[model samples]
Target: MTRSHRYRSLLLAVSIAVPAALGTAQAADTVKLGLVAELSGAGAPAGTNWRDGAKLAVAEVNAAGGILGKKVEMPEYDTQTDPQVSRALVQKAIDEGVIAIIGTVYSGSTMVNMLVAKQNSIPQFVGSEAPAIVEKGNPFVYRTSSGAQKGVPALTPYFKDTLKAKKVGVAWVNNEFGKGGRNVFIAEMKKAGIDVVVDAASEQAQTDYAADVAKIKSANPDAVFVYMNQEESARFLIEAKKQALPMPLVGEVTLTEAKVIELAGNAADGAIAHVGVTATATEVPGIAAFAKSFEDTFKRKPTHDAIKGYVGVWATKYVTDKVGKVDGEAFAKTMHGLCLKAADHPKILLDTCWDDRGEMSRPSFMVQVKGGSPVVIGTVPAN
Candidate 1:
């Protein structure tokens, strides 16, 4: 080729290479987001699932050119499902300059981190569904998952109308999450004219639940509403089964976790539960595709923990990008009035919105374990 032809070719190559290099440079610049999860202890299943979901959201946002023209980076800390450990991690996260925070599967841990975030003026998304977390008047703390007050509305109706259960029993872990769920469930049951025969509470991270199970067995209610994390709940269910306590079992969202079913086996079959998001409930915009992507990426089906975690990241991003800044004050303002629609992502189970209390208003799906998987039975409206 002639000199002029070679010069033209070289110019085209430079033009292409320069833009690619610029894009790579832009992608390297990042804004840090802190993530706290229970990597060990009873809450590991939920923590691991949440971690995968958040990572997927971050990857997708970065691939699409990131938020505010800066690649988002998540620096994670393990809480070991302990409130004290989570408290320390929250301070560390703020000190390390993460713009926002996410997670802590247990309500007790989330409460600790939420207070820290509030004190530090850092925006945090509490992964637990305890009503008390948001009711604490923390402006910096927001929730993507609905708490017991919101989820139990559907649960009580299912017990009263669908199952036609009159007498009921309640057993819960004695924590903020359990208390919130227990209180709301009892109130709703009363309104629906269902009698709560027995109510019991146990310490968190409980292993042997023979005594507790015995109380529930003695109550002999037509249906039971249990409030505990997956691991402990599995143990409780196993013990209940061994004692031949055969009544219709019902529980909170954690009961639908794969780990619970795996541990409880046939004991979990025919169990009813209320969950915000499930692989079997496809109400979100791109749920089918998201599930396929999640399975392809993690080699497991996404659970309520994963779905909520993914939504939390996107919800944070929505506010961050909307305000064109990732500051705590701006986020607090934008997130309060923000209402996201289902068209945003198919994996999102409900249209996202928040009330003045910083609690989410999202629908819950009533599901039953059938053939070793949760099957959607009904959709509960968000009150």
Candidate 2:
């Protein structure tokens, strides 16, 4: 070949290679995190709040400067509240090059998808409170709130001392979240020498709770412990109100969430719960500011799931900064036994600690529905 032809061929190779390298560098200049959650289907209330809260935190993070001096990019994938779909989405997020994962708020979905994160050695922050999520020994998986094992036992005192009940009924959705909470509750009741007069299991997204409430009513327990997702909890409360079941209705977590109260309306009144987190705890300056900001942005009150998501992202940032890099393995290693003080990292919004198992510990609340709203009746110290 001629010299000019050879020179042109070399120029073409350089032109192609330079842009490819530049593209790779550009991509590497930003940090991508996946927000995978149940944005639709039965878990929408919790998932949407989670997504919005993460988005809010991401915005603030970017405004202040991003993790490790790289811009933060969050790509969202809707899980549709299906466990298998959530598992697939987690894999997809990792395949797409996300440094970390935030999502699958439904415990069943989290249980299925968290393995994907573990396999990839990607740190995942979840809003799921199922004790089994941490029990699996996945170092990559972490909770934004306390698990049922920790939160439900706090209710034992309320049931045995406050209610003074010898008999209680249990109504739980048969998902991982419900099952874990239900199991812990039953054990606690047994320890307290309280009898479970009725134990009813409902399905996810079960609209009609007439039968479940009927069984609880027939048992005539002193109180009914309602352990279900937000929508199902609302439906159960409405049905219980309609049947005029005279026993007190109590629950943990989902029962007193903003979305549940909104859906159940007056039916939610007189309901009580032990919540790992609540937006109504305005006594905390950080939470009050977060709730107001969330309300202003979303035009609705934030739920406990929202706070979970917000803190999850901020905790990601806090720990990432502590590690001084975005390495997923390092992030996971740093998270175990790490404690974040709100005084140091205001975005975390609370003083929080994590065990080696990635379970979270923070102050919680005992809430009651009054005047169609949740009011914090007491505080539960961190476990």
**Which candidate achieves the best lDDT against the true structure?**
2
- Per-candidate RMSD vs. true structure? 7.5, 1.7
Lowest lDDT sum, 10 consecutive residues, model 1, at 341-350
lDDT, candidates in the order shown: 0.82, 0.92
CA error at residue 158 for candidate 2, angstroms? 0.7
The C-alpha TM-scores of every prediction are 0.89, 0.96
Model 1 ranges off by over 4 Å: 1-28, 283-285, 344-349
Write the residue-wise lDDT of candidate 1 on 1-383 in tens digits.
99999999999999999999997675457887888888777678889888888899889878866778788999999998888999999899889878888887788898877888888888888778887888888888888688888887768767877779989999998988899899999999999888999898998778889998889888899999988888778888888888988888899798867778888898787778988767777554466667777899999888878877787787777778888976788788877856787766433446778876788877667888998888888887776
Candidate 2 local distance difference test against the native: 0.92
Question: Under the 3 Å rule for N, CA and C atoms, how many clashes does model 2 have?
Answer: 0
Off by over 4 Å in 2: 1-15
**Model 2, 122-239: lDDT tens per residue?**
9999999889999998999999999999999999999999999999999999989999999999999998899999999999889898898888999999998999999899999999
